[model samples]
Target: MKIKVINKGHHALPEYQTELSAGLDLRAVLSESKVLAPLERVLVPTGLYIELPQGYEAQVRPRSGLAFKHGLSVLNAPGTIDADYRGEIGVLLVNLSNEQFEVKDGERVAQLVIAKHETVEWEPVETLSDTERGAGGYGSTGKK
Candidate 1:
């Protein structure tokens, strides 16, 4: 699906790294390097604006390599960008490791995944249907 986007940053528009990739790498737009101290979090802008059709959303997710190698993560994993939103895309980044992480311009910091969703209306039901594992959650199912 083709999407309409406005890129105000210096870097090129986000693109899929491979043919079968489900997400596009989102680059950081910054004037200077920003240090992320351990256990600290910051909102990093992408200088991008998008116009998504109804029933669709853009998910902001963490880069796996950055999360694994540098203990960096998107604070709000899978942050949702609604179809009606028309503002700069920003990623909430958090440093989960002990060492500091430097965020530079054009650095791949997050992934953007466009997804289609359904809008549900509440039925105001009296009770939900019973299930085999009703009300069982939070590790209620034993691990293998």
Candidate 2:
């Protein structure tokens, strides 16, 4: 439940008031920004470090405000933070907006959620069991 931040930024670390907070918080590095087209994706850096407890993982997710307002989002939605990754946390952000997005320093870029996971051994199965519609994807259950 404790995260370590490396550098001091223009803004404070983003915290969660609820039980599920994806990322602690981070600042944006926008001086050398990339130009993107409408709906294009760019890698946005989140300058933060993390120290997660064992058996828990951090998921890099997009902030709802950014997504709804400017179509900005995390490129690798739900990016994973491995338990052993003792490195600075960076977010891979993308501009899903039509126009070029200017992300200033200390912007609330994304959210981080701490989750519990299990390390499992892979066991091969001979045959898979069938269901009503097994492995049917992409709106197999008619669009609403």
Candidate 3:
């Protein structure tokens, strides 16, 4: 599906690194480098605004390499961008390691994944069906 986007940053539009990649890398748009101390979190702008079709949403996710190498991650993992939003894309990044991490202009900081979503309608019911694992949750099954 085609999407309408406006890029005001100095970097190219986000694109998938591989043919079968599900998400596109989103770059940071900053005038200068920004540093994040350990346990620090900041909202990094992408300078990208998008218009998604109804029943779809854009998800901002952390890059695995950054997370593994620098202990950096998205504060709100898989942050959702609703279809109706018209503002620039911003990523909430956090430093989990005990070191300072610097984010430079046009640096790949996050990934954007466009996905289809569904809305639910209320079906007020008095009772629900029963199952073997009816109310069991959170480690209900064996760890092994």
What are the lDDT figures for the candidates, one per model? Answer: 0.96, 0.73, 0.96
Q: Give lDDT tens digits, candidate 3, residues 1-144.
A: 899999999899999999999999999999999999999999999999999999999999999999999999999999999999999999999999999999999889999999999999999999999987778899886644
Error of 3 at 17 (Å): 0.2
Per-candidate TM-score against the hidden true structure:
0.96, 0.76, 0.97
- List candidate 1 segments past 4 Å from native: none
After superposition, candidate 2 runs with Cα above 4 Å error: 3-10, 17-25, 29-42, 142-144
Which residue pairs does candidate 2 place in steric collision? Answer: 21-112, 21-113, 22-112, 22-113, 23-111, 23-112, 44-93
Better of 1 and 2 by lDDT: 1
lDDT, residue 80, model 2: 94
| Range of the 10 consecutive residues with the lowest summed lDDT in candidate 2 | 1-10
lDDT per residue, candidate 2, 1-144, as tens digits? 466656434446666646764355545755564565677665666656667788988888888888899888888889998878977677778887778876666676777778999989998999899987788897787644
lDDT of 1 by residue, 22-138 (tens): 999999999998999999999999999999999999999999999999999999898999999999999999999999999999999999999999999978988999987789889
Which residue pairs does candidate 3 place in steric collision?
A: none
For model 3 the local lDDT of residue 85 reads 99
